[model samples]
Target: MKKILLSSLLLLVCHIHYAQVISIIGSTSPAGNWSTDIDMATTDNITYTLTNVNLTTATDPGTTGLKFRQDHDWAVNWGSANFPMGTAVQNGANIMTQAGTYDITFNRSNGTYTFIPAAQPRVGIWGPAVDSQNGFGGPDVDMTTTDGILYTLSGFYFSSGSAYFRVNDNSTLTYGSVSFPTGTAVEQGPSIQVAGGEWFVTFNRSTGAYSFTYPSIGILGDATSVGWLNDDIDLITTDGFEYTLNDLVLTDGEVKFRKDNLWTTNWGSLGFPQATGIQDGPNIPVTAGTYDVVFQKSTGHYLFTNTLSNPEYSVANVKIHPNPSNAIWNLKHDTTIDAVTLFDASGKIIGNYAPNTTEFQLDGSNLSNGVYFIKINSGRDFSVQKIIRN
Candidate 1:
């Protein structure tokens, strides 16, 4: 009975010493030396939590490593030394973190960690004349990093050269590497090489991983002939990625650009957005008119220029009559007429009359019974009228 009681007491003491206690050690200054223990909760047997931890600092952009451990012991820690954010934790690995205030929770039983960032990450891209393709002097193009650790710059084009990921918009503080796989570490290195073409680029500063891929781009919306069809009218490729569509008629509606004619990959904007690199933004409104549209695939910028309107038809000034005239018709006008030309429905000139007078006669004895277009020139402007014959 005494031996059994002693064994039971030892088991109870072991459970109390090994359960409900956790802490973290990392690359941030607040994490203190890995040697010291930042004790967490003792009440929960399966989970541990920490709050209001600030990971932002000057060195924060490069990397922020973290790992949850039992008490102050490294042998019982969890993480993959270079693991990216949102990944499941692994024993003996280091968790990669971004610069932001966050509430971090770890599940000891499942080897998974949850990070709730308090703020967004700052991201942008820059390079020399060869890589940016915007001459040597430039303000770098910005990027979106909503997932905190992954930064993406879409519709990017560059020549065969190199560039770096700018840190906090500061050119001096930047990171770079070669063509790398997703989820690799982003260390301080030389510029990355690129080919000339349009691309969607993604970079993870925490893991130094980067990648790029080609994209299909075109315009779509209600203003076009296809009327909001995802793959209606496509822009003509000027270069490998830049596009232009000449003489397009648009109605009073909205428009957007999509990849391969799908809503899954699309872009739009508020107002008559132009000249700047846009994102997956809002819809752009337009009116009924003919235009020439230009889209820069490398930058996601678009421009629409209205074409010249058709010449007006002065029905009040000119008159052509004789009721299906099989003989001849009189063309009368009040203005000083310079010339009059008759054209068939196919736009082929049937006859040219230099009737430099206000009144002229149109002979239809040798013409077919059909519709024709009569053009009149006066002063610096021109007008058109439709004439019928029997």
Candidate 2:
């Protein structure tokens, strides 16, 4: 009896430690704008559009107020027919003040889609097909297979012209294996038809670039005839084979691609590498070592770091004080005490101090208005916090 009891207790402890609580709280005006607060296990997909945001608690899993514009015309001003329009910035909270209809979407471990809108739109936000209780922005696609399995894809397509695909029951949509004509751009559409058994889709043999319609699986022609080369480029596989731009490159090394105005790299099978470089347009050659690399176009900077080994330090905490500090600015920690080090986001350490000091007051009068990080080290434990010095 004691053995069974102890085993049960251990199981209970594990369950409690792994359990996550995600809650969304806020006030939305009937006009389609809102301010909200969210507290969750992780901010994996939490997004908001607003101008000002605030956090009221100091707990690791505390709550934050997200602000955004909820007016319907805001989207029009930005040339978007959508009701909400505005920019979103996430600090401890998110803020957006554009005067249009807008919806904030978030995803966490429990699956995706927790929409926060100022007011319900006429068409309403689409919910997930699997879990109707949760909502997602834009249309949702459901592909059923003969094995009684379902697949769904979300997000808008960013391409020139759109392409379409179909599937039938028992038949699965095999990406990469299917070939698309050169310059063919595929965009995800609102929906696609898959027969009950099995089916396949083919793109037109046209040589021009194509892209998908927003929220729909349907393809559309480019509004302007700017040609195909600049839209989608051809790719050469490591197997010494050439694949169309439509073929999804799946390999152990790095995969590079250009999106909008930026060049991006995904470490592929190399997992995380010590470094990665773009050999060609979208081809990334990773170092034999492993390290995750992230690139920012606006700043023209590449950030390389190790993947998460400890969940506690995976994401850095961020705090900002907009008001000018008369004396000093306080930097606080929410976890076990560790050595605190400050940097100017340029990877240069500005100051370092012992931990458990409750607060580290910095002489902000000499600092400029910009972003910085306060890195905390506890034994092998490491975490970073963002601080904006006004």
Candidate 3:
């Protein structure tokens, strides 16, 4: 009987120590701004969980403070004196953390807790021999993220082959292979076979939403000569990321730039005629005239203006034709005087000419079939134009 009584007392003591109810409190809450307790859910007697707990810091959203307490009381709590990300503490200061979704676990038996950053939604592309720019056999091309959640990547050239999305750079953390419709969750199933094309892609990791946009970006609408036709005047990539649509004739009509020649994903600006810049905000209005438009994708800074007038924005009046020229090329301009210089693709000076006249012929039969730049210094105003010689 004495032995039985001793065992009963020991059991009571163990229950009191290991089975006490624990809760979480913090500045950004479910914790009532640290004034109240948010009880943690428990599955086993020794394990507790608080899933999807939102947290933030005191001064900055990226930093956070939090702690664990017992029975909605602060007299007994767990925190860290060192305040490490995953370090456990008892009767200590609040734990420091960054703003993110977390799955926090506390083990009563060991006085241990795990503060894990939840698996974030991310999407990347990995393929088998897609192209040289994105070669197959592993290292995937990651999309750029602005908000750390949604991501986008554009200007990808893919051959007829298969690819898939992954949560991370790791090939193991991948989604399903089948070509999911836009907004559908990409599962970790099979590789998606794609036809040969240049593409744009976007992904939302949170909802498994993914989409592949075709390379159908062009100038269209009644403002343009095409007027909603499939033959949209395509923009050429000048600096890879930035694009240029040259010599577009628009009547007095509304115009916009769009992708896939669709109403969706269109860009324009109500703030038109601003000498400062253009952006992808509202529909742009145009007066009748021919113009060259430049769009900087990374900055959304664009400009549409008279090609010849704005030397800063347009190609120079000096014209080089048969641009994809062969051995012989013609250079013509109304203004004359000063030096003309030719540069290779790498900006290396190839030839210098002191023509001192308006018209000149460039003998380039010796040049290769690639891109070049011609810098014309007409004594007063100078401009650089790209030349492609075949």
Candidate 4:
């Protein structure tokens, strides 16, 4: 009877501890008032996450307060006057939160917490061309998108096979793939079949509009003539390497150089008149003028000479054969290379080199299957290219 009584008490104590749900409450909430709670989820008792929660001052302005409470009760709670991350204190000051959707993480063990700006929800591809049928074989190849709805993968060399998109990979949120690249992308929808050889791939998440365009690097965004459509004003080339778009007009807007008019392979972030375009950088800003634009495909050196409103965005495509090679990838440019840095999808540096040579080779076999970016520097010129491994 004593053993039975002890077991009962132990079960009761365990149940109470396990049932202690942590919640985010106080002035900011999707519920519009401090009267409600946004419960956080946890797989382990130590760390809790409240995902896709909107903490706004829009509805209740000036009340940008936030806190984490146990079981939606005030008795057990934590707060701190911190923007992103800090150690929590019981009955502490409200966190001054910015108005945005966030993935809030709290470590119950150490009272440490963070409000990380949520990554945009996105989708990616799995195919024979990318990861050797890596759907069941390996991780899907992630796509790039300025607008979260339209995902793109460019300059993808194919061996006459097909692919599918699995709406989630590294993001905290999950979604479904579009089959045809046109129409509404429904959850549990049939997998997409995209096929070709060396093509630019684009898939729309909201509307299942997908396309494969023969690769060509050109200017895109609202600042250009076409205004953000796929109909990019193609850059001209004489030697098939250095590209030029002479006598072009731009405006006081934003623009980026892209391949096949998609964000799949693009360059921006270098400043006006002349600058080295970073791969997948932010949109280049144009104050206003018409100009002569120059782009070195091998080096990513871009120059905009203005006579009218603004300068210009220009680009050229660098082809990859047998996708570089089996074990090593070579970067060959006309100018002297000072340094090289390779980054993974998470913006984490995986490889760094100081070759200082026009011709440089790096091992590709060591990289895991996924998307990677290689940045090269030559004098003031630089180039960033997306490298893929299956």
Candidate 5:
């Protein structure tokens, strides 16, 4: 009877030890040596937390930050190279942390941990367009965090207006830029004048690097007239939400619609003539024929009609303003441009440019120009525009 009673007592002690065994240890993690254990507090035993834990010293952020162990022993432990927040595993690498006082939370159930800095605040966007969707004077559209440095908000419909990021959602601390699509964030800066559309937005609180995705959808693939080039058959958007192309000639191949000619977001499907597409879907099939295509942006629905007869939409649309100018001339295209070369009527190369922009401003005051052929290169295709300077 005594033997069974002693065995039961041992089991109870083991259960108690297992239930109360989670602590941190490291260099400058409030501990100069690894021989000691600093315990954590837990109410449910599933989530362990340690508040106001200093993970580094004042002079330097030590290379090795901290790791979690159970019962002051390494028999069951969790560690990871990722810091601020990450899922740790048994026998993993050491967690490297930055210099700051943090309230740390570690999930005993999933091995996920988060180190939230005390000094850093939340970042969010505020504007009329955001207010329309998120509601006026409501909570700002909050950007989420992983490492707590770069914050992001995706697929947000920000109507063309002004927007900016404010610290803690209501603080006077602000980060803004001059324009949309791409720019660096500036404190106490002017409002960001958006191009007005739905886009993926990102902002880095540390470096102030931020960008909004451009809203341009184009057709690509071997089935396109341009064929496997980085170039796209630019579409026309009368409503800014749907794109269309008239007189497009395609051979028997496959195609897809990508945003801004980038594969970051794309649509494809099996059905032709009309169908709905999904992101990273299968390539869309095509037959040898001329087609008029229409695509819905918000939804992936598309339609193709081969009955229309109009100009072929296989070439880049370029406009040369003030072709006959004294000093300055402007060039623009529907798509991203690569290079521009100037050739005299005598078939001699007069000027060469590699300005990768939608618009190129040319100066012809130095040239005694009677007639010059300007070649604009987009992807593998090229367009020759005329310039007359008298």
Candidate 6:
């Protein structure tokens, strides 16, 4: 019985020691000799904690802190020997780093601890131009070269040995385009990668024109045909090329076509006089069998040059009462009407009547919940009103 009691007492002591808590104390120095100490004490359920320390004296003594609670896998490893940096309590995954020497440290009581060494300085491509424009809300890098050439830096390194760098052509670099200067140096740290090497600094130039390519072309018509008729015909060059048209005038004789910003073509005569209203033009005459069609422009109030064959319906005076009607709808129009038609949403005629009186009331109560259009035709004029059936 005594032996069993002694064994139970030893087990209790081991359990108490297994649940230990650790605290870190550290100080920052401008001379670059910063140091930290970890202290451990017995606890009930507390596991581990993590904190981040900044070496650069930029803000708040250059020290930023991060903590992790209840961490089961807590271990420390040497991050860099030259920089004398150490990482603590990485739970999972292998530690990755760039070129340079590093040391590792690990400690655990009830659980196993593992230390993984990694390199330092994590070399990568850094863009000075992108960083500078970040504050101004501009493009990461601007291509000001007339040839439309752009350059970006690319390269990789493991920590900080001799860094390698190369220049990548983001835009086609050609002759006469602005290029990056050769032999540029870059710095990488924290989360940044700097470019290095002579070629990485310079940009390649291109010798191409600096204009945007537009696939569609536009054409304008003379003032007389300028109305609706102007939109009827599309213009194209004789060689089947597309050209934009502009600066049209309404003269007594014909409409002329111009190329680029100069070189006017012979007057393209129209069949009808400018005074006569505009109507849709006939198909273009075929000389070479086919031609590219350009965009149409407004010459006048109408879109074409030909006069409308049917007489237009005009509404003179119209009236509606109890406009915000809940059931019945009443409509009145001037002149004797020939026919009155009501149309639904699909443009289908729902009701028709032979015109007699000037006033008519539509029994909207029978209509479903929706909107309807009423068309009234009188001799040469017609009027339409929107009626709600709610």
Best by TM-score: 3
Candidate 1: lDDT of 94?
52
Off by over 4 Å in 5: 1-120, 132-139, 215-275, 278-390
* TM-score of every prediction relative to native: 0.30, 0.23, 0.41, 0.36, 0.38, 0.24
RMSD of 2: 29.9
Residue 173 of candidate 4: its Cα lDDT? 32
Candidate 2 lDDT over 277-374, as tens digits, reads 23233334333323333332111123334443333443244332433455366655455446676676454667777856544566656777766655
Expressed as tens digits, the lDDT of each residue in 356-386 for candidate 6 is: 7777776667678776666666664444556
Total clashing pairs in model 5 = 1
Alpha-carbon lDDT, every model? 0.64, 0.33, 0.66, 0.68, 0.76, 0.35
Overall local distance difference test of candidate 5: 0.76
Candidate 3 lDDT at 167 equals 64
lDDT per residue for candidate 1 within 167-285, as digits (tens), equals 77676667776653222425467666666555667777677677766555667777777776334587776233446788888888988877655566676777562433356777788
Top-lDDT candidate index: 5
**After best superposition, candidate 2 residue 121: deviation in angstroms?**
48
- On TM-score, the stronger of 3 and 4 is 3
lDDT of 4 by residue, 65-115 (tens): 888888777898888887778999998877877666788899988899988
For model 2 the local lDDT of residue 335 reads 52
- The order by descending TM-score is 3, 5, 4, 1, 6, 2
Any idea what lDDT model 1 has? 0.64
lDDT of 5 by residue, 209-262 (tens): 898763678998898877655578888864445577888889899999987666
Cα displacement (angstroms), candidate 6, residue 308, comes to 17
User: Once model 6 is optimally superposed onto the true structure by TM-score, how far is the C-alpha of residue 304 displaced, in angstroms?
Assistant: 13
